[model samples]
Structure formats: C-alpha cells, structure tokens
Target: MEKTLYVASLFFLCFWTKAQENKPYNYFVQESKIVDSGNTIEVNKKGDTVFVAHYKRQDLINTSNQDFIKTYKGTPFFKNGWYRGKVQTGTGMEWEFVMAYNIQKEEIYLSNNPNMEATVMKPVSFTMEGHTFRQYKNQYYEVIYEGGSQIWKEYGCSLIFSNSSQRTGYEAEGGDEYDGEFLKTVKYYLKEGDRLREIPSKNRLFKLFGSKSNDVKNYAKTEGLNLSKEINLVSLFRYYDSL
Candidate 1:
C-alpha cells in the first residue's frame, strides 16, 4: 500500500510538471520598473520576471572630449529604472534607433524603427510543440516547420498610392514654389500563406480562397473568430491542419 501510494504521488507530480511546461509564455506587455540605483525589474504578460542592473550608454563623444562628434538628439527616459535611449546614427540619415541595456545579462536589444514609441524589447521567438515561431510585432509570424520549410503569414496595414498633383506655395514675397502631393490609402492583407500576396479587393478573396473559401468561413464562424481581425495566423493554421 505504501509503495502504491508513492507511485501514484510521483505520477501526479509528473503530470503537474508537464502541465506547467505546456503553458504559453506571453511575449506581449513589456513592462519594467526600477527598484533601486542601477537596478530594474521587468515583467511580461506571462508573469515571468527579470531583474536588470548596471545599465549604461556609450558616450557620443570622441576621445579628445572637445566638441560633439556624434550627435544624439532625443532625450532618454527611464521606465522602472531601465534607460531607453533613441540614438541617432549621425545627421542627414533617414533612420532613428532605440536600444536597451541589460546590465545583469550584459545584453543589448536594438529597435528596428525609431518612429515607434515603445522602448521595451519583446521576445522575438517562442517554441510550441518543439516548433519555433518568430513574431514581428502583432502583424505576422514565421513558423519554422520540422522539415525546415519556413512559412510566413502577415496581416497588416499597407500604403496604396492613389494620385499625384502639383500645388503652388507662395513664400514671404513674390516667390512661388510648387510641391507635389501624393495620395495614399490603408489596406489589410487577407488570408494566410507562405508568401505575402496583396489582396487588391474584397472580390479577390474568391480567387484566393477558391473552393476552400466556404469551408474556411464556416470554420471561422464555428470558432467565433473574425478573419478580418488581428487573428493569430499560426494558431489558425494549426487548427486547420488538425481538421
């Protein structure tokens, strides 16, 4: 009886451990706070926490310490004690940058777009069922399959060029200057596949979906999901594969 009870208890423990392993880690909700001098704590939506300290930035000056050689225009602020800096790559460049210093890990995460306001670095990849998935913001995800085939599905806003015209602008005096105006539109990508194909119109969904259109719509309705929403394409495809 004693041995049987021990065996049953071990089995239950293993089951609980497996359940914890299957829980998804939330990469969203990048929040951080400073605890003390040079110390900061960061937490994600999944409740996983990390403590960082000793954050520092490279001074934008030459060894001579004379005049400013490299200029960084934007001022950095601390969130939960972690310093976020928008470091410009010199002047006359078309790009802005942001970076974070993890003093404990001695690591740095660079922002691809300076125009974005968020400064916290998000986890780029997560594993599910031994398959690795990479996320690019909330727009799309790239799934690396077991056979090494990379499948990408992206849904987001894209600019559409409309029309162009020239308009005259009058300066202080009699000088007149002409400027070109270009119109644009916002559109969303529909459907998921290995390639990003632009949907010219809602009518094109018929061609894109072909005979599977009705089936896909039915499945979406049954699941109470709207395809037009920011759906998780990876999870959607996984459910489709199960069918």
Candidate 2:
C-alpha cells in the first residue's frame, strides 16, 4: 500500500514538472515607455500568447503586414517615428506598447517587436508620446486641451500632384503621374459637450471669447506667449475654463 502511494506521488510530480516546462510564451506590455513585468494571456503572432495587465482574456484580431508604405510620399503618420503609447482596445483592455498612427490610413501600427506585423486594435482612445487622441465621429483628433471647454486638433494628409515637371511629352508619360508631395493639414475644434465647432481662422480664435478677449491678451502678454501657436492656446484654455 505504501509503494502504491509513493508511485502516485511520483506521477503527480512528473506531470507538474512537465506542465511547468511547457509553459506558453507571454509578450510583455510596454507602459509609459517601459516594458514592465507581465500578466494575462492574449493572442499575438499566431499561437503565441501575450501577457498583459487589467484584462480578462481579450483577443487581438486582424493580423497582417503593412503593404502600403511604398506608395506614399514621406509617411501619413502623425509622428514620423514610433513611440511608446497606451491604447484602450474595444474590449476595454488598455495595452501600453510602441505604436505609430498613420493619419492617411487611419490605422494604428503595433511596433517595436521583431515579429510585429499585425494591428487588430480598434482603439477606443490612445495616448502616445505625450499626446492624447480620441475618436470624434470615427475620426481621430488630438486632444490638445481638455477642461470645462476643450480644444481638439485634427490631422490629415493629402497627396498633391507636381505641376512643374522637368520631363515633357513621352518622357513624362508615367514620370510625374504618381509623383506628388504629401501635404499635412491641422485643424482645430472647440468642444463644449457633444458639439464640436470648427475654429475657422486663427485670427478669430481669441475673438470668439468676446468678453474674455482682454483676459487672454493679458495672459499671453504676461507669459510672453505667442497666442498664434496652437499649443500655447492650451494655457489660455486653462485660464478660460477656470472662469
């Protein structure tokens, strides 16, 4: 009877050791520009599991390689390079990782991994490189300022065809057909609640405040701030919102 009990214990120990040895792969998550110790399991790179925190078995879908880089002038990305960022996925799971937002493509690319080739992230919102972005009407807008009143910036990329072509006639048949400069657009919006009003001209930016125009002028002058700059306008928003 003692020998049988010993054999049973040996079998259990062997099974536990095998399970530990065969433990699955877990991809660590990057947060605030650092990859911290991991938790949770999710799919990445087919059959591989990603370890993350504050998530209950959320799945990452739509994995594919980026196939549109060669056709664009420069890049449609908000920033030219990737940076560590936090993304709140559709499942409400927040994953911090290195990523790039392609404005033209309207897609976020998961980056910094050797085998990184997939983006299934339907991001509810994301913060990257000190800039916070949220979706407004299915479009991504940078939240430059958020207070009682808010300032949002929209980004766009457009390809402008070259008009002055050195090559002429047959030489230029296919030469400058697709050759063009990619132009970027930055537009601002003012939000009170569900409504977003476009700030048409920068000259009229301060004028919208009406009664508070003098206060804005005073703040800008005291701080030696260039009110024309969009970023500096955030300081104005902070003061305005307080009132």
Candidate 3:
C-alpha cells in the first residue's frame, strides 16, 4: 500500500510540474530594460508568457530631440501616411494615437497632428494600417504568424548619400539635392524560445519546417501558394498550426 501511494504521489508531482510550465500569462512590455541590445522574448514550449524588452544604440528616445522632418524621395515609413494605432505603455495602459514608423531612423512617432512628429518615449507595440508590429533590436518586426512559436517580418532601409564622389563631369550635377530614395528591404524570422532564426530564402523556410516539410509542400502545391509573398507565408503557418 505504501509503494502504491508513493507511485501516485510521483505521478501527481509530475503533473503539477507540467501544469506550472504550461500556465498561461500575459506579457508586460518594458521599454527601458532590454536584452541583447534589442527587443527580446522568452518563448516556452507552449509559447505562453512572452517576456518582452527592447534596446538600441541610438540616443535615448525623447520628444524634445526635435529636428524638423525632411522630405525623402520615397516614404521612410512602413506605412506611407499617418494611421490610427494603439500603443501600450509599460504600465499596461493602452491608448489610441496617430502613429507612423520611420524605418530608416528606426523610430516610432505618434502625434495628434499628422503633419508633425515626435518620438515615442517608450518601447511599444503598435499597428500600422492593418498590420501589427513590435520592436526587435533596433528595428520593428511585424507579427506575421503566432502559435507555439512566432514568425516576424522586419522592414529595413538604408541611406544613399549623394554620389558626388562618383560623378565624372561636375560635382554640382553628381547627385541631386535629394538625400537618396528609400529602397525597401524585408526579412523573415522564426522565433522559438530564445532562438530567433532567419528564413532567408524559400528553400530554407521549407527545410526549417522539419517533420512538417512534406505537408507544407503538399499544402502549398494544392493551394497554389507562393511562399515568397508575406500573406501566403502567414497562411502556411496558420495551416501548420491547425494540423
């Protein structure tokens, strides 16, 4: 009888441990504290209880860091114009604001006046147009898929200074007054636990699916999906989660 009781106790202990591991909890985002010089998350086996933090090398974000906005050949924002979005503060209070993401400077701006801009003072998650975005490192990545794991897409930009050095004929005609246009760049990633892996190419993404690779291929074939497209890629993950 003692041995049987001992076995039952052991079973209960194991079950209780798993219950703790699987416990669901909400994430609290902190803008001041960050890990690895970027927004960091700790994902568990069940992907519950996301712990989020953010950081970057840029000078501290301040509303008074004012310099008037400059014109660019192409939009510097992930969205071309101001959009209404919700920004959650560190204290868990959320507010609606006019928001735009400046991809080149890697900063978020919110203003009541769409023509004016001010840097957001804290790390935040916001939606632009219809897409949701969260900071990862110095950049913000869109949440493309979420399940036991998550898939994020980062929008990237680079500056192209005038080509005065390369101009053969005249320095004046070398590069126009324009600073240079925004050549958009994007990258996809898989976030599992503390590991953030980039899915650089279509082939790499397929292989990363592991046991689900064959199913993914079959599903894509039947649905006529081109994984290169963001919407299609998101659908594939949802389908995989359903299975």
Candidate 4:
C-alpha cells in the first residue's frame, strides 16, 4: 500500500509539470509602450504580428551550444509577418533578431541588439498603395504587388508659374511688379495594359472605364470618392473591378 501511494504521487507531480510546460502563453498585450525587458510581442496596423523579443532567461547549465535548439522555444511564433530567424555568426555564436516599431510613424525597425536605438535601425518593408516596398541604402524598391508592373517605369512632370503687380502708393504713382518662381514636380508611373499611366490620378478612371466615363463619374460620386484626393490606385482599381 505504501509503495502504491508513492508511485501515484510521483505520477501526479510529473503530469502537473508537463501540463504547465504545455500551457498556452498569453504574455502579449496590444499597447503602445516601450518594453524595457525585451520580452513582448507587438502587432502592426496591418493586423500582422511583427515585433518579437526573446531574452533567454533559462540557466545555461552544462549545454555545449547555448542556442542549439532544433526549434524556437518561447512565446508563440507568428507565421504571417516577417520574423527574426536563428542566425549563426562567423564566430559560431548564434543570435536572434529583435524588432521594434514606431507606431506614430508606422515604421518597423530591426536590429540584432535588443536595446538598439530606433534611429539607427533600418525600417522594415511595408505596403503602400496596395504594394509592398522596401528601402535599402536610401533607395526604394517594389517587393511585391498584384500586377507584374514595376513601380518606376516612367516619369511625368508638372510646371507652374505666377505673376502679380502691386500699387505702392496710388494708381497714378509707381507700381511694383512681382513674379513668382516657377515650380516643377516630377511624378512616377507604371504600365497598365498597353499604356504607361500615373497612379492615383483622376485620369486613371478614364483608362479603366474607356468610353464609360459618365458611369465612372457616377460611381465615384455615389461612393463619395474625391478623385483629387490622395488615393491608392490599386485599391481604387479593385473597387471599380468589383462593380
């Protein structure tokens, strides 16, 4: 009877330990605060789980490789967004990447250093106008999009000039002449179908609708869409396509 009771107690203890280890984690909270310990997960505006920080707190013990685990073990790994995979340094030391975001700026910054400065780390790739773009060494490149068109296929320009005359004293007296400087703006374009077109332009609807300009205008009016406002062409195209 004594031996049976001891065995039962030992089995119960082992079962409880295994249950604790297998329990789901709920350590992350969706708040806009800096985590000093680097032990939190953050989600971005696109509803993608992005930021992850894992500070190894377990005792190293007599393990040969401190970070030689076959798989990641810690907070649940997010499968949708970009993550810091295990990397082996030249000196054989393994490290995990840490990431942070500037919520106000809508930018994700990455660094190997857990306590890295926000200004020093590079911003992660993001979607703009329904396309993913990446910035490297001050140059921007389109990473992914629905259409197989390059972001910078062609360029357009706008020029403006103004002039005015002011009377210093009376109409009979001398008048001062003023001329505004000419302002020019360069715009980017992409090829849609057979024509190269500027994005987010009022003329885009004309291209998409062809002879149905009136119908396009009516649709835009019904949807309260201001063609002059800054808009995402891809999103606008999708909306029109649905109709």
Among these predictions, the greatest lDDT belongs to: 2
lDDT (tens digit, per residue) of candidate 4 on 26-142: 223322232223434445455544334332223358643221111111222222233443322233333334533232223443344444332222333533234344443343334
lDDT of each: 0.34, 0.60, 0.59, 0.38
| Model 1, CA-based lDDT | 0.34
lDDT digits (tens) for residues 2-96 of candidate 3? 98667655743554455346423111221123222222223335533222222232336653321211222455556544578877644455656
lDDT of 1 by residue, 1-243 (tens): 698667655743554465346433211111212121232344545553433322223335743321111111111111222233433222212222344432222222444444432223333443222323344443323343212112343322211212222111222443221111112223434324444455444334435445666775566667876444434333344454555
Give the Cα error of residue 2 in candidate 1, in Å: 53
Poorest lDDT segment (10 consecutive residues) of candidate 1: 66-75
Give the candidates in order of TM-score, highest first. Answer: 3, 2, 4, 1
Once fitted onto the true fold, the runs of candidate 3 whose alpha carbons sit more than 4 angstroms away are 1-71, 114-117, 165-179
In order of appearance, the predictions have TM-scores of 0.25, 0.58, 0.61, 0.28
Which stretches of model 4 miss by more than 4 angstroms? 1-109, 114-196, 203-205, 228-235
TM-score of 2: 0.58
Instruction: Report the poorest 10 consecutive residues by lDDT, candidate 3.
Output: 25-34
- Error of model 3, residue 126, in angstroms: 1.6
Can you tell me which runs of candidate 1 are displaced by over 4 Å?
1-195, 198-207, 232-235
